[model samples]
Target: MFIPVEAPTAFQSFTLVMPAVAVGNVGQLAVDLIVSALNMQRVGYIHTDCLIPMIGSNPYATSAETAGELHTAAEVYMAAEMKLAVLQIRSPIIQSKSRKFRNLLVSWIKASEFSRTVVLSSSHGYQRDDQQLKGIPLRYLVTPALQVSGDTFKELGWIEMERTPPLPGLTDPSTEPRLSIPGGGITKGLFLDSCDAGLSLAVVLVFCSEGDNVPDAFTLVNSLNSWLHLVDNKGSQIWKIPTSWGLLFGSGIPPAIF
Candidate 1:
């Protein structure tokens, strides 16, 4: 269920952005950069039992004054002037309820009547095939409903995620290429759901690993910025790193350890 802090209708026709729980959590970190940099307002939250319940101090709080405000597992933030909305998911989905969660998201997206939806995600770098390893680490996918021309991506110098043969190095003609996103939690499912529903959805993701992924996050967000131009990047230090990110590696080591 989506519980609104303001009018639910405020989301209508807005472009929705969200992250998939995947390897390195790069998508979530990119979203953090967007929210902190834009100073978007909290609009609503999706209260679903499908995700593990969790809460903490505001991740984007800039000062002592705002530090104590609570934030939940999944919350919506909006930059109304830009007609953009972001859904940040901080907790993992319950394994048994993954399908349910995807369905819930699809339904909410449809009901909200969003102009389009963008999913940010990451996949395992080591799993890439020879072709996947040859180019830039970034890739994109757009559902048919978007009616996006291949020329659009070609002009942007972006590569579409390729479908690989189910069995690599196999000579059998019966085998067909298929879309695969190892470690991209729910990304494939949600995209397929959007496709079946004829929703305008696109997925932007990076190939990455599982440690010190901060740089990967920057790379992913920068790639997204190339397409969306969400912020002016001409200046130095444009994207603000949220205060919460400071503790990403955890509190300082104890003096006794030395």
Candidate 2:
């Protein structure tokens, strides 16, 4: 992986936000909203052999002259004044390299001395039990170091994801508590890793269906806003969607085709 700029010093003490490519692509889309809303500038990118290679026009670019600038599989953006940085990963990590990539990320976060990190992720809507389906589709988990940041979560009456109890006769041989997140890709692993390593990490995720997950992204980001106060709740401000979103799914089939 590549850290092109002077990332360590530039984002010291910053709170980094990243999304796992989980179900419905919720995390990735939510991060897109954050990057566009904050107008965050790209400082560098993480180029890893483990991720599916991808390249596209810069989604956060506003000016015509630079609209075609390249965006990589993973890019870093920052609002230095606020000590907040975002690492948006647009590609899926290969299964064999997932653990290595997670270790690499944790190392960078440690070496960079980031004050905290927030991971936006999602799980399959179909798997939620009745209890999980009763409230808002959101749930969160916080590392010990992130307790202070979770105050708003408590105030908001959000649920913390429950550990799936082992079946009466089908328990695993391991004794440690299990955190199962079906369809969440590597989210549980990453969060658990951070917790084990004593990093100030918070994971916020939603249970969502597959189609049109845009609303889920908004809800997730707003949940984050409640904690980070990234934007005032006042009506004076509004979340602006990026112009590049117009091409998200590409042009649809011609009406005549049907």
Best by TM-score: 1
Q: What lDDT tens digits, residue by residue, belong to model 1 across residues 123-165? A: 9999998899977899999998886655877787778998888
Q: What is the per-residue lDDT of model 2 for residues 80-176, given as tens digits with 9 covering 90 to 100?
A: 8888999999888999999988988888888888999999999998887656778888999889877573367779878999776455234575854
Q: What is the TM-score of each predicted model, taking all chains together?
A: 0.97, 0.91
Model 2 C-alpha lDDT versus the unseen true structure: 0.85
Cα lDDT of all candidates, in order? 0.92, 0.85
After TM-score superposition, the amount by which residue 252's alpha carbon in candidate 1 deviates from its true location, in angstroms, is: 2.5
Q: In candidate 2, how many clashes are counted?
A: 0
